[model samples]
Target: MEPSVFTRIVRGELPAAKVYEDEHTIAFMDAGQVNPGHVIVATKRQVETVMELDDELAAAVFRTAARVARAVDRAYQPEGITLLQANKPAGWQTVPHFHIHVLPRHEDDGVTLGWPRKNPTLEELSVLARRIEVKD
Candidate 1:
């Protein structure tokens, strides 16, 4: 399979405004910045989704994201911040690579994310939760 855009960036075959990197992850400014401090933190392994990552690699990705978020907060001092991670196309994941978007947010920034609430009852919620609850 061809490498995703992120893979090329990681391999130095493409240009990116890189901000942070480690053995397991790399972070860079997003080409289409929703905000001034918008950045993407991705796994170096080139996995397409978070489900493909083992616990350790997944944790590393979030660790780097948190680190970059702090830096972005300090540098940009936005009114708020958003950490977004999407899965498949249905989940709004345009790029196949697993990554997190650290977005510095402000009022009326034009970004909108909303979903209708189901408002299931307590018993109904419990039943649904039990269906997918993790078991050791």
Candidate 2:
């Protein structure tokens, strides 16, 4: 199988402004940074999407992302932070690997996110919530 771009970076085969790395995860400055301290934290397992991630990978990746966000907060001190993870083309995922974008946000940063908020009734929400609840 052809290695994903992230896998190449993890292997030091490509260039990246790496921030932090552990056995299962890596944090690096995004090549196309949205902000001064924009970062990308990714799982080393090379999963194509979030649904492909195992529980361990999910936790590890988030843990690393949180750490990177805190470091960014300390370094950049932006007004807000955005932790974004997209899946599939329909979800705006450009890269195939599972990764999180840790973006530092400021007012008038020119960033915009819009989606039709489906306002559900209380009963509908409760039913949907119950449907997704972990029974175990």
For each candidate in the order shown, give its overall lDDT on alpha carbons.
0.95, 0.93
Considering every candidate listed, which one attains the maximal lDDT?
A: 1
Q: Count the backbone clashes (under 3 Å) in each candidate.
A: 0, 0
Q: Write the per-residue lDDT of candidate 1 for residues 1-136, one digit (tens) a residue.
A: 5799999999999999999999999999999999998999999889999878888998899999999999999999999999999999999999999999999999999999999999999999889988895643
- lDDT per residue (tens digit) for residues 3-94 in model 2: 98999998899999999999999999999988899999998878889888878888899999999999999999999999999999999998
Q: How close to the true structure is residue 39 of candidate 2, measured as C-alpha lDDT?
A: 97
Tell me the lDDT of model 2 at 127: 92
Off by over 4 Å in 1: none
- Candidate 1 lDDT score relative to the true structure: 0.95
lDDT at 125, model 2: 92
